[model samples]
Target: MGVCFSTEIKDKSSFHTGVDTDGNDHSTNSSKVSSVPPTPRSEGEILQSLNLKSFSFSDLKTSTRNFRPDSVLGEGGFGSVFKGWIDEQSFAATKPGTGMVIAVKKLNQESFQGHREWLAEVNYLGQFSHPNLVQLIGYCLEDEQRLLVYEFMPRGSLENHLFRRGSYFQPLSWSLRLKAALGAAKGLAFLHSAKTKVIYRDFKTSNVLLDSNYNAKLSDFGLAKDGPIGDKSHVSTRVMGTYGYTAPEYLATGHLTSKSDVYSFGVVLLEMISGQRAIDKNRQFGKHSLVEWAKPYMAHKRKVLRVIDSRLEGQYTLEAAHAVANISYRCLSIEPRFRPSMAEVVKELEKLQEPKETRPRRHSSHGTRTRRLSSGGLAAADDAGLGAYPRPQASLPSK
Candidate 1:
């Protein structure tokens, strides 16, 4: 779970300002869109929102088959997510494998931060409806118990698909990676475009879930914060997020902005191209930081191939690789002012997906041929003499 420093209740601000790193003002909307309601201050007021259902604790228990171990789908800092069945029309509990399937997250009783996170999830998801955001079907709030119900995502998380090594978890194709990246970018763009401007504090690959057709949807809003209002430049809050993905400026100062989310997005994008964790201690010397080790290579057209996942086997064109490198480099800029807005990033990614003629592959200075290591591992070695890097083991808990 994400760490929280302020003990104060959630902010009650009515509106927020969204200034991109490049000084573009995104907070204003000329379209005649309905204004969002002010955030509810209490649990009672939040639960009263008409968009969500109030599920009795007993009903969820029955739906999840008494929270049996066999029904568990995944586990995380919040708690275990159990596969459950519910009636589509009445939203009533049903037998296993019957009716609509849902993922029920039962909060851990011992987690001190679980309640706050759970409330944040409901508060944000209840009011927002978008194709890229996870759907919250209902929530159960009983004395000393907190649980949330969500539409089940069949393909699991992008983290698993990109990092996990197994027959069930296939490597994401280059096209699929671009698709997921675009979907996630659109989701952040939606949050930033909101009249009240929500800063998604946590944006690592683990929080990006995938559906049956490989469509990406963002999950986990526990660390989300309302953007600064009025003339304030940013919302001052405690630094809280996964270590490698957190922006340097936010880590130094408690000031938070939408650009912080942009930095995290850059890290995820780099991970997709390299098939490496943001910070892998297991890596050899001088190669632990994905951004540090790969950014220089990304600067040059031919050298960029050095960092591309050898697993890709040159399936992606040199031009497309260079374009992605440019985007990530801008996003991971030391000065936030140099980074492009999410809207701009989305437009750049869309250009990559447009139909175009296939061009002949450009051979790198270091030959483009890739060969398997003798050890029967998935290591891919090229003529450049880059050493074999082991595949990362699954370290983070699933959402």
Candidate 2:
């Protein structure tokens, strides 16, 4: 399950609108178009503008097999995501494993903040179409029931691949990790681009969903906020995000910025490199907080092995590992201004994807042979450099 914090939406006023419920022009002045389009004011108008299918409660209930427990894909604070099938063309309910597969997130009625978050997801995802961002198929808002339908992510989340230990959850290969990281970074870069300019307040591993080919797509826009407008530097809001992933300045002053998302991305990148949770209380005193524990190792060239995942022993190259560590270290900088923009981060990650010649193994003082490398420069390490470090047993509870 994933976690997120909630804050009250200050202004609930409606905005300008033009679209109709069915997304058709019922207006008599269809020929005349305004140079400036009207902003979406009400929920219905916003939903109308996107041209998303308006699904009824009965329609979704049929699509999700009456919301059976067996059909569930995952659960979070907002609701349970159930696996379902729907018609590819008509968007109607279909038998399981047939037609197009979809994930139906049925909002928990008891959650006071769920409705606002649901709308936020619809608002952002409905309008924005990006390969790295999860696709919003449609939505359901019949009476009090609110549900969001999204394209099915067969491989699940980056969180499970990094932390979960089981046959179903395999540790992602080094190359795959880099691929996922780059894909996620591209997603963030798209959101942070001048046209989008949205701050993804919550950017943990769990929100990074994977498709069959292991391509990463960012999901859950509940905490996403519009970037500071005009001369404003940051959007002042209540501190809301997973504890370990939230940026320090945002946590202290409640000023949210795109740099805040960069910090969270660094935390996720660290999690991928170390195969550890961001906030693992079960670890030893000095190792509880992943960022704090790994900072020393990340900065030190030789000591970098102490933080790299043992499971990824021979999978990554030394130079590539160090480069990724440096990226994370810079992104995790205390000063938000010091953090590199997502676009810059994307460029650095893209460089790592380039093919590199393999270098011969070298032996350390401890006599353990360096691990073999397939690409990305020199070989990694064995038990020589990586000291006996205990893996964290517990993870932060999902909200």
Report the Cα lDDT for residue 120, model 1: 79
Residue ranges of candidate 2 with Cα displaced over 4 Å: 1-47, 167-169, 356-399
Q: Give lDDT: candidate 1, residue 396.
A: 17
lDDT tens string, model 1, 18-48? Answer: 2333333333241111111123422434656
Give the Å shift of residue 204 in candidate 2. 0.2
lDDT of each: 0.70, 0.71
Residue pairs with colliding backbones in model 1 are none
